[model samples]
Target chain A: MNRNAPGYVLGFMALLCAVFGAGVATVHYATRDMLAANERLNHNRVVCSAFGLPVEGRAPADYARAMEQALVVATVPDGRGGARSVYRRADADPPVVGFTFWGMGFWDRIEGFAVMTADLETLVRLRFLDHKETPGLGARIEEAAFLDQFEGLRPDWTAAPDRRVMIGPAAPTQAGNRVDAVTGATQTSSALMRFLNEELERLRALDWTSLEFEPLPGSEP
Target chain B: MSVRARDIFKAGLIGDNPVYRQVLGICSALAVTNLLANTLFMCFGVVFTATLTNVTVSLLRRHIPKRVRMIAQVLIIASYVMMVDTLIRALNPDIHRFIGPYVGLIITNCIIMGRAEAFAAQNPPWPSLLDGLACGLGYSLVLIAIALVREPMGFGTLLGIPLPARELWWHSWTIMLMPPGAFFMLAILTWIARSRTGAKETSA
Candidate 1:
């Protein structure tokens, strides 16, 4: 059996693929539960953060307990054939809704979560999960200075699609929906503004009351 | 260690460094060096992949046909990198979130492939493993040095911890956090390292 022969080469390649494929599969399968738990913890943390719940310095178990006790989950049509999970605060007098939003950024896709008031007219809070923006320039979106602008700001849902929530040079008073964009990050600012406004519009159009929501595990049904 | 192993380590660390000397794997060197945490994880991923890939390639060198060795090497490298990614994602999701975008870059890093092709394909398994590790460490050394400067200057913090008396004297240098900052640091480091090495050779 010549090592260079076609049969030997093919056999070696097949063996290599089988061994490596199986190795990767086994590791992935073994870690599947841990990965899922990590993801759930992150989700709970994000939801907790979005609604201004205490997350910093809290344990993972605390986040889980908070999610189980304070939030309800609903699966809704995403307008793209897939269903997306949305979270609602169980006890907020007027209710608060949170959902993940993502869109193209300066260099890559930026993903974050947005929480809105029950009417979907005011932003409760915004927090990023992942972004590939330039570190000092565009990546500043994650900074409290930038993200805090969205909190308590009302989006003019009646305004045109593109003008619902502006992200640019806000007036000195900082009273309108317009928020100051990060300096020296025009491209990232524009891209964020577009996606965020689009997400706001989508949120406004959704019928929240009609969608069925199941009480989270450990919560009173 | 044997003299031969020492020589391999010396070559990987100083004589034929994958970053400053050989000028390989600059993409990740520049990309992840701005943040110390990111650079550390990137180094771990590269070291894990390079060392394992080298051992695997050397063990199979006799059986692997020359015509298709590249593909086999790649499959091995990719498998190891995937495992590293999975482990990091599972064990430390916070760091994973910060370095996640750059983890996939390990597959294309030239240092791992360069070692597998240049040394591992012909060497014994143990020597090849040493070479891979030395090269990975060489790359790590340069990246960690750059991150040490870049993070402090750019963010006025070390590993996100605010520097003591930061507000009194610290000022953020935005450029230090960008790619151009890496270019400057890499060039300066390479020049200093080469000058010292050149002087050593002349004196010897």
Candidate 2:
């Protein structure tokens, strides 16, 4: 147990290195391709989910194929800087402005991306993409019940994406807007409301006047 | 290979169970057991580190300097742990993410270091190797026991994958996968082991 000796130290070092070196060599040879493929797929799937798109069942080789026909990435700006949206399917005849949305909860961050309809007033689709919040408590943000609440949401005159959701049974204060928060997750809901406002205001400030609206393939009324 | 190896293996599995007996690797047992797959990976990592560390520590004990031996021992342990981390990142990166900092934390697991200082530094290489393997298996056994209950109860499934349609009948005890559940499970396990083995209070 005594630690001061030189020969003991050298011997220990040699034995330890020898054993670990062998382990590394074995692992390197066995798992090189699998790890690389995992990292690539994980990143791609998150991007797909960000746009309300799905990629769960597809194998790695099919990811590029999914991206080709399914998604469209557009650059949009926030107060912080510009953001992008890779919409799963924007069915509008003329595509409108797109935005990336995000929020902070008690434990971690929640974020997603969305594509708006041609008029810039209605939502194309919204998806919650990433979060690291506490399981069962804050993690409920990932639940479909919470996410589906955002499906038809749109702006009104008084309730700009500027004000936070007051939560706890406060009715939506304006037309074309709603505010029924998830039970036991008020703080998270409120934060989401605030972030959405900030993101929307930033979207409003952008100079979209010069950008041409191309008629989208599926934007039929 | 020898009777000693078998004895060491058996001791870890039954005589000196890590989670239920010594309760040595409880931190990971609690945190990762929330998912069966995570627990299984943690067990694999611990076993690998303990077995290899023991054999090396034993082989080198003769030349280790009295004053500087602890530092060298640490260097040895850290080397193995880091190597595990790198290989995971390179080979099994998905599991690596779930394992997170625990790979680095393995150096401080006390079990590996304990075996090194206790038996490895004193024993021959073969026995040392067996002791390491035994300790790892022992740790895995207790962890799997906890995982068996915790995963199924918390997530309403076994391991990361789901159970058969028949077992879908079980109700989820949501807390079984939480931190408090770990404490409860560990306590119950300790009680069971002590009562069954009639272990000496001072030793446990």
Candidate 3:
């Protein structure tokens, strides 16, 4: 066999591809169920956390149980001709809705969740799920000092309402929606504020009053 | 075990440490060392990928055509990396998110490919496996050392334990949490290790 021949190279490459392709496919299939279950558990945990539900030191199974008992999944149109899924507290006297949102940060994608009041304007809590912002600078968006400002703050929706959540240098003094940006992370802060407000506008347009409870995909009914 | 096998393993850990001596895999060392937890998980991922890739490459070395061997080695390495990524994502989604991109970037980590070409392509399967494990450990040792200094200094905490910054009057060095700190730390570490070993620095 001529090892240097084009035929040999092509055949070897094909063989290598077949072997590795099979290996990766096998591993993916074997782990698929577990990965899906793990992702569901994490999503439930984050939604629970956003609603100020107890999740610390609790196992993922426990979080899943808590989510099942306390929240109902609702799918609403995102005003983009697409469906948006949100979790609402089943037991709240006034329904609290939680949804995940994503936006481009200074470095890469930043994913977060905002739990809002039934009126769909007031933020109950905000938390980041994942991000690639620079540590100690842009990454400060995850710090409680930054996120705490979003809690209980309502997005101004009156006539000529403030759609932009101004990220100021100092502590927010505006009665309308404003937050103090992280020092030195103005781009990330601005990006976050922009994305959150955009998502809030989208949520405001969602027909919350017409939402129907549906079992979450992959959850036991 | 033969003396050759013992020497091969020892070479990676200290005698010719990948990070300190060869300065390979520095990109991840700098990126993940700010947090102890991130560094530890990244090291484990590297170790798992390296050892498995080494064994797989060595086993197929005789059959792999010389002209296409590099591609074959890469294919094996990438497969194992995906498996590791999936496993980490399943077990700890949060940490998985933190290190997901880096884990994929392991395909470009140099150390794995370096060992495959230099060691696994020539050596037997068992020896190659040991060499790969040693390389991973060597890399991990250097990274963990950096993390030890960086995490506590930057965050005023060790593994998330608060270190009484207010009472102890210890101010966190903000630089320690950034990329430049990794550069300084790696430079100092390489200098100290080389000077102690009486090895002169080689210019690239």
Candidate 4:
């Protein structure tokens, strides 16, 4: 057999792909259940934290229970031909609405969750789930100093994009939604503000009362 | 150990180290070495991928067409990396969440492909496996050393445990936790390793 022959090369490549692909598929198949469970548990943990629920030293079962009692999911059109998840905390003293949002950061896409008042006006907390921002600079968005400012922030939805939620320097007396951007990370901070305002605008336009909500899987009704 | 095996280890560990000597896979070394725990997992993934890819590539060397050998090697490396990613996710979900981004990077780590091309393509299975392990360890050694210094100085802790009397003596050096810190540490480590080995690297 001529190894250099086109047919021979194609056959060899196909065989190799099949063999190695099968090996990887087998491993994935074996761990699919465990991975799914891990994702669910992690989701529960994040939702619990976002809603100010207890998570310290708690078991997976505990988080799942908390999620079951408090959380509901609703899908909303994400302007971009796709559906975005909106999580509503059913059991909070003043129910909270949480949704995942992502946008390009300085280096790559940044994904995070934001929980707002049930009325979707003021922010309760903002936390990042994944990012590839430059370490020590844009990555500082994950730190408390950067995120804490979001608490109690009320974006001026009626205002322009730049004025809706200002991330750059602002005085204490400055009006509208303002959070100090991470020093030396203007790009990331600005990028975050851009996507956040867009998401907030989208959320504000939605009729939350009209959107249907269902229990998160594995949660009690 | 047999003379052949001893020579392979010596070359991989020192003379032909994938990191300091060959200067391959530095992206990951720079990215993950800020934390010891992350570095350890990255090392395990690299070692696993390198060793298994070498053996498989060597086993298939005879049949793999020269025109598509690189593609085949990558496919093989990627499969192993996928397995490592899934296994880590299953075994330690928390760590996986932190290191998940880095796991996919193993397939692109130059060290694995370097071994497959430079040594594994011609060597027997056992020897290629050893060479892969040796090179992986060489890379691991450099990364772990950097992490050991970076984590303690940057975070005032080792493996997340606060250092003794940290409140009194430890003031975190912010640079040590960033990419610039990894650059300084890597340069220093490469300098030390090269000085001790007395081997000069020629530009390829």
Clashes of each: 0, 24, 0, 0
lDDT, candidate 1, B168-199, per-residue tens? 99999999988999999999999998887783
TM-score of 4: 0.86
- Candidate by candidate, in order, the iRMS in Å equals 2.2, 5.0, 2.3, 1.9
Fnat, model 3, is 0.66
Candidates 1 onward: DockQ, in order: 0.56, 0.31, 0.54, 0.64
- Which pairs clash in the backbone of model 4? none
Which segments of candidate 1 are over 4 A away from where they belong?
A79-84, A90-94, A102-111, A130-149, A152-205, A211-215, B160-169, B199-204
| Tens digits of per-residue lDDT for model 2, B1-204 | 577667788787888876677768777777777777777777778888898888877877776776666776787787778667766676655666566556777889988888889889999988888888888888887777888889888887775677677364877887896788978887888788779988876755
Model 2 segments more than 4 A misplaced: A1-33, A54-56, A74-221, B62-68, B86-97, B160-168, B202-204
Q: Candidate 4 DockQ score?
A: 0.64
lDDT score of residue A51 within candidate 3? 82
- What DockQ number belongs to candidate 1? 0.56
Cα lDDT tens digits for candidate 4, B76-156: 999999999999989888777667777888989899998999999999999999999999898899999999999999998
Q: What are the RMSDs of all candidates, in order?
A: 4.2, 6.6, 4.3, 3.5
* Candidate 3 local lDDT, B103-180, one digit each (tens): 888998999999999999998999999999999999999999999999988998888787765557778798999889
Minimum summed lDDT over a 10-residue window in model 4 chain B is located at B93-102
Candidate 1 whole-model C-alpha lDDT, 0 to 1: 0.87
